[model samples]
Target: MEIFIVVLILLLSIVISNILSRLIPFVPVPLIQITFGIILGVLPTGIHMPLEPELFMVLFIAPLLYNDGKMTSREELWKIKSPVFLMSFGLVLATVLIVGYIIHFMIPDIPLSASFALAAILSPTDAVAVSSLSERIHLPEKIMTLLEGEALTNDASGLVAFKFAIAATVTGVFSFANAALSFFVIAVGGFLVGAVLALIIARLTAFIRRLGLEDATFHVLMQIISPFVIYLVSEELGLSGILAVVSGGIVYSLQSDYSEPIISKLKFVSRSTWSVLIFIINGLVFLILGLQIPDVMSVIFRDDTISNFKVLMYIVVISIVLILLRFIWVYSLWNEKWSVNESIEENPNRFLNSLLTSLAGVRGAITLAGAFSIPFYLENGQYFPQRDIIIFISAGVILLTIFIASFVLPLLVKNKNIEADKNSSKLNQQALKSVMNAAIRLINDETNQENKLAASSLINVCEKIKNDNPIDKEDIKLTIEDRKIEKDIFLLGIRAERKEVRRLLSDNKIPPATYEKIDNSLTKVENCLSKPPIIETLNRMDSIKNFISKFLKKQLNVNPINIKDIKKIKVLTSKAAIYAIKEQINDTNKKASLAVIDHYNDIIRRLTTFTIGEDINNVNKQRSKLHLKALQAERDQVQSLLQNNEINRETALKLRNFINYMEATAIEEQSF
Candidate 1:
């Protein structure tokens, strides 16, 4: 019952933390969760986890770190590998040595080994916390990647160093040679284990795909289990579990057939799952931190031997040191010959960007894990010197850093090159122009006389942008109105002709061969009209038109085509052009459809343009024009029937109407 209640409470805390995160924009999520946790801890009926330090560390910290490795971009990490290596390894070691020495001097009663252990534990930064903060603040990608990569690698490094330091304290022995050899073995062994495992999994996936049993559920199951398996295998081999996960992620990414349909579906599912998991984990961790505050404060107050005021003062001072040290390290490196961005072209904003990067270094889970992992006792049955105090100080620093990053960082840094708000409008304008151009090129390429009217209608649409703003509010309304009218006319024409054709066939007035042919033709037109206009075609048309317009303006002596004039021409020629254009449009559409069946290379491109619903209207307009031409061609045939006295003027007129309807339907079917 107690266990159940505790679990329920923890889950509730997580939910509350997430809600608070959404509500508050300037406060870091972890901090909010922690505050909630502290309130819960102070309550009379609050839940207590009673977690064993090692179990807690392994369960929470290990998976969190492993997840970070899996999501990080490999190519970006490789670009700044040098700095990431130095910061994760060299800087962490330096920080440990310096902090250890200071602690030993200030607290004479504390063992040097225990002091070093504390320093080593505190050295690694939290990748999750830093990544979350960086994303919100719009931290430069290069710097964020550098920090994330370093944080990920150093978790393993820091843990290894802490274990070695604890061993030295417990066993009363220290050997530099042993430490150096163990580090190399662990890091190298982890990489190998991860790589081999990933290769095996990828091969298995390929085999399954070849067997035609590639399902999203199976792929998702593999994704869920891969990280845990990689970590466990590496840990069993006395290697870095974090590095194993990192290596596996890189290998799997390289080997997997990500383009497969099943794989794409799995990716979407996996990504959403991970996002929710990370959010809950981070929120719970912070909330737990907050809940533990009252317990920590009680310990400080109850123990009269250590002054509570002095302990709080030390925590505040050390946090300042941590923040300042990061700035000093980054800025000093920036000034050196081996500085980041030194090889690139220099700019005044580079220093400012680097400063913002340095300021973004906020501590969270890694610090908590390290502080919590401190041993309770020294070699001689004495309490680990200042262990409780160190944990308290680390927690305080984490809160302070979160505050500064959330509120202060944004004020200090501004992106000079481009703002996100401005970039959106620019991208929209570029996209609109590209689509208009592609439509015009498609129309102009028509070779059949029957298709010319449809082509001309499309040309008018493309040309409208020349005289009017394509993106203007009023222009968009007008364009939409024209589209609506075209759709209605085309659909009405299709319905009227389909009814007439069916009636003629039912009455047996038309021959069976002619009836079947007309029915098939009407079905094709119906299918074409059913689809909506292709947004991609519109975008591509805009691009092609803009390119041609620019080329003509710059290189050609001829004046640009008047888009307004084209629109007017379409309106005037619509009735006369319908039949012949409808037939040509139908032929083109049939060619495109057949091309797909025959596996023609350009079939996909042609079908993409021709199948638009708006093209139905465009086809109808062309057919009206073509019908006029066809009517002219059939004049002799009609006159011969009249001269032979086989048909009266009334019958001839009805026959002409039927022919016109058939041509209109055909043209409307294939406007692309």
Candidate 2:
């Protein structure tokens, strides 16, 4: 009951924070959640959420890092590989050493090894937090990409360095050669493990699909566990788990996700699942961060509290060192001996770009997680040196860097616009015109009315695209506004698609009954003609959602529950789940008609369109037969498998691909 209540409170806090962020656009959702988490801790209820280091790392950060790697475009990253390395490894090492020395000097009582551990904790930048900040500011694309790319690899690098530092502190030993060799072993070993694991999983995915054990539930389960699996395996081998997860994610991207997706629904839900889960995880991490202060103070410092005033001074100075070291490193090396950043270096605003990138190095959840992971006791079993103070100082660094980076980053980059090469736009326009001209010529030469009509639509779209100026110079403020509006429309976009009727009644919310009048409607929208853009947007959204959902689902173990039932109960995809909920709760009369495509059959010398003429309707009436044929085929397949002992009777009974078969038939029957 206590656990349930705590969960409810946390959920409510997140909900409230989301609402407040939408209502009050100025403040980020994370800042609000942090405040709430801190306040919740101070409440007299004596409730404190357990934020065990192992649980947080394995459960939260691994998936987050994996998602980051999987989403990254290998080609793009390769293009900027040099700068990314310079920033990730070169910048990280510099910050760790410099900041370590600064903190050590600030308080002579703190050991250099402990100071380096703190340095490691503060080394990695939070790409998500940087992105949120840059949304408000117009940092150059190159700069933002540099920051993001650096962030993807630096967490592993920093964490690896942190391990060595911690080991040094624990055993009171220091050897540069050993440390360097260990770094090579840990980093390289982790990459191999992650890469091998990802490949094995990719092969396993095919086997799972072949066994007919593919569904959304399985997809969600696989996604949730893959990171932990990678992390745990690496750690068990005494390798860097962080590196393993990162390597696996990037490898997965190159190997699997980039393929043309078949399952639209799975793809959609997979994206939503990761996005929402990562969001919640990060938010809770910050909140949990705030909650730890009270615990650390009461438990570790009960007899002798650290000097808060001196600690505050240390935080400010160390943060300055962390920020300044990057500036110096980038400034000296950005153009000095580098071809990767040649264009960026030659840019007039190069220094400003460098400055923003340096300042945007905000320590985030993983930083705090690293700090918290420091064991309470050393080898002697007395106590880890200055453990509580390290946590406190690390917390201060996170807070300062986050605020300065979020607020100050925008100010620094104000009025600065980053763009691609000038020839890029010209090349794009040339490509568009080249295609549009061919399409128009084909339409003009064709004798078929359907072809001409389709050609005309394509021409109009091209003209509109050219006229409306589809490509806009990257404008941060305007871009954010557009995103917000698009988000709004998406959330409120789809129509009330359910209709409860046979001959007389209308109740969208009620279940279908034999005696009672019952009618079911798929997704529908009103005024599609008038709101053509919105309709197009809605269609594109649905198709993407469908493809992604199906793709992700097919990679998982087959679940007993049907997709419709899974969708109704909360789905793993929070966005889709929300939409489903809205549909379930709302009662409205919504009707839809498909975009009647008039396809021309050259051999038959006739135009076939759905519901256009009596003959056309008759021609399209084959849809039902096609649907039935697919169903019968599924039935036969399931029976054959059961007879062959390939599947148990229990599993055979639940083999439901009827929905997919029907959808495929609908698509097939639409052809001329």
For TM-score, the strongest prediction is 2
Every model's TM-score = 0.61, 0.64
**Model 1, range 1-672, lDDT digits (tens) per residue?**
987777677788787665665567566556676777878888888755543555555556555665666666787788778878877888778767887787677666668887787677767777767866654464444666777888888877877888888888877899999998998889888878888987888788778878887676787677667777778778888998777877787787666535554454455556556656666676666666676678767877799998878777766666666666666666656533222432221343546655665566677766766677777886788777777777777777777777777887777644432343344333333333433443343334332676776556545744664345333223242232233333344554445555665666678755554544444444554444443224324534644875686787668665543433322222222322243224444442433222222221232333344433555545555655544343333443443333222333433443343333333343433222
lDDT of each residue in 390-476, candidate 2, tens digit only: 887777788888878767775665444233344334433433343334334333333144344444544574465444432332332
Please list the residue runs of candidate 1 whose C-alpha ends up more than 4 Å from where it truly belongs after superposition: 1-9, 51-53, 208-213, 257-262, 335-351, 415-672
Worst 10 residues of 1 by lDDT: 592-601
Evaluated against the true structure, the overall lDDT of model 2 is: 0.60
Query: Which stretch of 10 consecutive residues in model 2 shows the poorest summed lDDT?
Result: 591-600
TM-score, cand. 1 = 0.61
Steric overlap count per candidate: 49, 20
